[model samples]
Target chain A: MSLDLFLNQVVPVRQKLFRFAYRLLGNEEDAQDITQDALMKVWSQQEKMPELQNMEAWCMRITRNLALDKIKSRKYRLADELDRAGEVPAAQHNPHAMAEKNDVMGKVRQMIHELPEKYRTLIQLRDMDGYSYQEIADILELDMNDVKVNLHRARKAVREKLQNIQVYGL
Target chain B: MDYNQIIAILDRYWEGETSLEEEALLRRFFSEPHPDMPEPLQEAVPLFGYFQEEIANEAALPDMPEIPVVATSSARVVRLSPFRHWMKYAAVLLMAIGMGYAMKQYQQREVKASLAEIQQQKLEAETRMAYLETKKALELLAKNLNKGTTQMQKLSYFNDATGIITGTN
Candidate 1:
């Protein structure tokens, strides 16, 4: 029964878990390792399955913790911006337009990345991953109100930066 | 969609009051090009555009490696012989023998020490006995010598009397 539940429910979310870890660690290999470790952890703690209401959030929480621990243990720096400069596939036809678009997107990425880890994680989890505030709260082990307030602050900070960029073209 | 509605949603989004649906709607709205984009919407375009691109890129990530199945019920339990850890048993036995030898040696030393103490105590008692006997013998000799002195004193008295009688004066 436990194995079946694991294969059905927990195994299917490895991609999401990997993406979440990747966003946190900013490295594919580390993200993959963290994902596998999270799965193994979930599998090992199968006795808690019956009591859990949201297994996916628990799995994500585990992945986030592992990734954060890795970041903390090694004082890990995210991959260099130049390393990911070509990551976003360009859709523009003109060379100049593509370069400009890439440049703008890179700035946006950098802006988000410059936010504190908590704020960056909140933005990515809510805006990019489309997780509900409650799900995010569960994953982050925070109160729902705290999640909303922090997310509001994070978005506000980003908007201020965005306004600056729009006005100064910086 | 009306520009006003987009602006309202964007405001709510900035305040973090927008639901997931509204956020998704905003993402969809920004994904398309607006020929005459409003001033307010321009600031959010890049941000939403980045989110859309990030989502796309994440979606394009390859599937994770296959997970191995963990068997729960069919776990095999192998029976073990009693001497699986013979070295540990040997170690324990050796330790016990060593402790026993040490205790025996300690007890033997204690017995020998007590015997020597007893012998020493006996010698001390015998010496004390000899000293007391010698003391008693010397006391008797002293008493006899004192009696002889008194008799000699009496004889000297008698001799003086004889000398007086013999002088006749």
Candidate 2:
């Protein structure tokens, strides 16, 4: 019975968990390990499975905790944003316009990375992953209002930076 | 959507009030190029572009390998090798050999120590016997010397008496 539940619910969310882990750990390999570990942990704690209302959020929470613990234990350094900055896909046909777009995208990536970890995560979960505020709150273990306020502040910060980049090209 | 509608949604988005559908609309709107894009909407282009790129990248990621699950009661039990704990067995064997060798060395030392003690006792006994025999031989010589001294004294006295009688004649 438990196996059926796991296969039906938990296994399907593995990709989401992996992506969340990857964003947190900033690497694919560690993210994959954390996802696997989180799955094993969820399996071991099968007794709590029936009680959980949001199994996907619970799995993501487990993945985040595991990833954070790994970061703390190893003092893991996130992958350099500058290194990945060059990976932006070309969006323009002209060489000059493509380079310019790439540069702007790189700046945007850097701007996101420069946000505080909480703000950065909030932005990514809301904007990139399209997680609802309640799901994000469950995953991060925060209140709904707290998620809203922090997300607003995160967006405000990004917007101000974006304004700065526009006005001063800084 | 009209430019005014997008600007309104974008403004709501900046206020952190936009719903998921509105945000998706904004993302879709930014994914394409607008030759005459409004000034207010241009700031969001790169941000949404980055998000779209990231989503694409995640979608492009290789699927995770299938995790083995024992979903059925008839799942086969994996047989583990006996040598899986070889180090543990090897450590026990090493400890046993060390203890055995140590015991053998201790027994040999004990035997050697006892033999030395016995040899020392035998030497002590032989020296005591030699000392007693030498003392007995010296006592016998002293007794014979005493008897000869007593006979010489008696002979001297008889000679003195004969000298006195001859003076009287």
Candidate 3:
């Protein structure tokens, strides 16, 4: 493929790629770096872009793999973000913001974070980024039905946990 | 949207039945709650809000960096064929056996040299002892012979004197 076509097809997905990484890894710096890394990979393989089926999804997959590797390297757990809820009052004096420590969304974030990786990733791709089901399947290399099933289970798991957070104010 | 309609849509949403469009509608409905929005669905407002806040908090993506075109691995990867792998092991085995043989030969040579040195020392010591023993035996023989010779000479003289005297008698 010509450099212009590679530039056109690969460059525009930067924001979406960043968003995907940022959602997966709640760290913006790491997300930006992952986006760059993924893009660089795509650019390196520019000759193959013409035959590539879905450039955006392919790039997203690369970003997803790279982000997951980063997460694993750091031994970072999304589960730990919620675990830090107890430690939130170290310096913040705003009582309202401090109360955000125990907010439902915080619990939801943790619940989503605690999800099995495939479920969490599919949920993030579908619910947070609003990728179409097919796009998610393409990126994740899962069939559409499996994607739907996993997304359903992911949402249900979060909702079930949120039910607990509501009942006992976890 | 009627409260019943929203409730119905949320039911479908939880069951994973809502289309992307329907889900988008739910997000819009919860984006800013109407004053009379159903109390039950109020909890969903933050969930949708969380998604919004999460995606919106994107760091400004910087422009692509200049990726230097590094050489690919295919150019560098040394794929050893099965035959080559066997050849490698065979070469290693041959080297090891050759080294072992060379070492054994060196050791044998060292043993032979030490044994020869030991035999030479032993032979020199035995030769020196035999020479000393022979000298001691010859000295004893010479001493005894000298005493016999003296006795014989004396006898010879006495016989001569007796022959002369007996002839006159």
What is model 2's DockQ versus the real complex? 0.51
Q: DockQ (Cα-based) per candidate? A: 0.62, 0.51, 0.25
What is candidate 1's TM-score against the reference? Answer: 0.71
lDDT for each residue of candidate 2 in A118-138, tens digit (9 for 90 to 100) = 899999899988899999999
Local accuracy of candidate 3 as per-residue lDDT tens digits, A1-170? 34666668777777888878876776667778998889878878888888877889999999999998998899865435654455344676887855774476677766766789898887777776678988999999889998888888877877777677767776
Residue-wise lDDT of candidate 1 within B119-147, one digit each (tens)? 99999999999999999999999999999
What are the per-residue Cα lDDT tens digits for candidate 3 across B1-169? 7888988988888777788888888878877748887777865666676676555544343544454544545456777677857878899999999999999999999999999999999999999999999999999999999999999999999999999999999
Residue pairs with colliding backbones in model 3 are none
What is the full ranking by lDDT, best candidate first? Answer: 1, 2, 3
- For residue B88, give model 1's deviation from the true position in Å: 27
Candidate 1 vs 2: which has more lDDT: 1
Clashes of each: 0, 0, 0
Q: After superposition, how far is residue B82 of candidate 2 from its true place, in Å?
A: 32
Tens digits of per-residue lDDT for model 1, A6-81: 8788989899999999999888899999998999899899999878889899999999999999999999989878
lDDT of 1: 0.90
List of chain A TM-scores, every candidate = 0.94, 0.93, 0.81
Say which candidate scores most in lDDT. Answer: 1
